[model samples]
Target: MRISATVAAVSGALVLSAFAVPAAQAAGSDAGSYRADVAKIREAAHAASGKAALSGSTVASPAADEPYALNVTFSNVKVHSGKPIVVGAAAHVSVPVTYTLTHGADVDITASDFLTGPYIYKGTYAQPTNMLFGEDAGTCTVTSATTASCKATIDIYPGDGDLSNVDAGAWKAGAEAIALNGQDPTSTTFDITKVGLADQGGFASPNVTRLSKLTVNAAPEPVKKGKTITVTGKLTRANWDANNYTGYSTQPVKLQFRKKNATTYTTIKTIKTTSTGALKTTVKATVDGYFRYSFAGTPTTAPINATGDYVDVK
Candidate 1:
């Protein structure tokens, strides 16, 4: 399908050429088109920001003395239906950039003179990394007597090493252009010199919940009234790195009980789990009731409650 856009220019209506990049190459799917490449970019971009570089340096833009001169602008920079980018959500990010290349008064040019797309980068200005939005990318159409409108999608992958491990906050966006010939890069240079952030909406790491386990038991099924009843249990949660569930040690949990026929369970005491996620506490039996352990969970795990253990009072 033909995907085109119209840019309202100061002079008049500027028609954009039909976007021709396939779904596998572009940053996100085209409007009304089903695609996953764009989704993959966002997932990698927000994944971890990877252990790339974290330098505080900058580079100078190319001199205007080059063969051609150009300027670029970006719009519709967002992730997943224009939602703010959340790390690890596995969604697509769309960043469409438009380039307007200005030729020298003495330099004669044709529509085919402009190259494919701009040089896109992610991360901070001091630590930016190169990004490949697609193959044979970018499209250009003459909009005025001496200017042309060229657009391309800058797809981003949050989880990919290029993005997976950066700090959880605002990041910078960059675009540059040079002259491209049969085998050489573009000579006309244009760059975004200000704070151009792809995620102007906001950036965050999404909360992840892992599996949690809780257990409870009471010794001496039949105990006389006034006799002490011991309740014990262990709490554990999934360990991502370890790839297994292990004891969640030194955490607080609640010891709760409910009398027979009672509709609500009351918290009797607060207890901490040992290094092995073990809990132990005792209470005097006054009537037949049930005992259980409850965990409130952590940022990485979900809350859980142990099945009630019943004890009979004589």
Candidate 2:
């Protein structure tokens, strides 16, 4: 299996690249070569930002001084079906990616040594603050002699240092391809002239948000009509650094209600979370219904609705 690599900078920018190294080469002596090359580029990018350097292992072997640019372009790229990617604290999240590839007819994307896939990045492509990619190369179907439609997946693991809290926001989509052209990647004298590389950035923008959760509880399951009912709940969101969920404080949350037999819920009141993300409010018991807490969500956090808690009125 091809293992994914993540390049994380001290500025907390994480980069994931889906450079296609064959399964065999990925496990060999030079396994670190491709990653090292990316790390070096990341270091330069960070230095340009006047920020701390990126953290990564040294390159096991030197890479080509330069790679020949290939004739290729990526277009009509869409990520996560045009929806935000909401990732939780622990479990890995796999996002689907689709795009159109137009390349020189001579480029054999299907070759075993050729690697290509779509990625999402923040900041300029040349000096991205963060990037995300997949563990596998994109699967393509030829639409014409020079054009193809492709699909791939980008996997995110919050616990694996693949993300930080600051990473939750808008990201731009891009694509990259590398053709080894039969060169021995493990060889110390690997020739750069035979390598072909292509990169296209700023195709589309997608949102990535931290997963959010909510809970609702109405006190006194059976209450007399016109009596007071205490409603309480909590709002929490993923904390990437802690690998867990924590309170989402000071955010507005709505209390909503629906008649037992109703199909839709009506907003009762809007309240903000406490310092610890706790929610509490009181409503009069008038009829039989269900209550829930709803969050509208921010750019950095996903929207969520708690399961309704039913209450009986006697």
Candidate 3:
């Protein structure tokens, strides 16, 4: 994924928490210097389903009554692997994004007024298929005068079927933030215009692969010191649609051998599977040892190694 110059700009700031004030410190009345009212805002911002919904039309460039101007800086977006999101067994995923909201002069901040989360949209910015991931509570902390750092952890769940029609490939990450009115939720809205779109570091679909199976066997269990010994195996992988494991024809499998009582195994040769994923090969049996078939995984499937089959040489 390529992050547009626009998305790359809004990549700074930190997380948020409930604004706290000591009994002696007076609340600032300036819009820009005001901190948010935590209690009332939480009720309006969060839904029972636990997913923050920021599904409103694009507000005019500068909406009226927009309490504060925004300077959002998102942290590097990454998956659990500390890399681009790699969809896998865990359908639900969360990515961390932080931002700093600078309040306007005398604009009191509240939870309801602020909402941030991760968004995925396909096509051009002018016209795109947009999907919101997660917008839960962003525990915030006030860092400087009129500046508050907020961190939001966004969640993505494929099972929700939001990106079902979307192709299984790269998707842009558009981190968003909005300021709403406590009295009138839809009144005025302000957002960071330039959200950082991750470059080669956005969302990814699970690389779907069929389950693969392999087998190994050795012939002439009691072979002579220098007799020719045969090793054979079949490599097959599951077909998702068919729900069965079938031949993985024309793929290569490494024939490996470990000497008796040895800890490591060395590759003897590379052999290709037949049209039916069948394997047959010969090697000189020198010592009682174990033979196995190893397959280097493909894009869609994971790598696997079969259990070693022992062959005894008299």
The numbered model that scores best in lDDT is: 2
lDDT of 1 at 227: 88
How well does each candidate superpose onto the true structure, as a TM-score?
0.43, 0.82, 0.47
lDDT of 1: 0.48
Q: How displaced is residue 165 in candidate 3, in Å?
A: 14
Q: What tens digits encode model 3's per-residue C-alpha lDDT throughout 1-314?
A: 11111111112221111122223222443221222332112222222113222343222332221122244444444323333443332245566655555555443445544554444444433333333334254546777666666666555444443233232344444444444443432234422221111112234323323346889998989888899988999987644333346778889899999989999999999999999999999999899999999999675554679899998889
Window of ten residues with lowest summed lDDT in model 2: 1-10
Please report how far candidate 2 places residue 279 from its true position, in Å: 0.5
Q: Please give, for residues 138-190, the per-residue lDDT of candidate 1 as tens digits.
A: 66666666555666665544323223322223333333332322222212332
lDDT of 1 at 312: 95
Give me the runs in candidate 3 sitting further than 4 Å from their true place. Answer: 1-73, 82-212, 220-222
- The clash count of every prediction, one per candidate, is 33, 0, 28
Q: In terms of TM-score, how similar is model 1 to the real structure? A: 0.43
Tell me how far the alpha carbon of residue 57 in candidate 1 is from the true structure, in angstroms, after superposition. Answer: 14
lDDT of 2 at 187: 67
lDDT score, residue 284, model 1? 91
RMSD of 1: 13.3
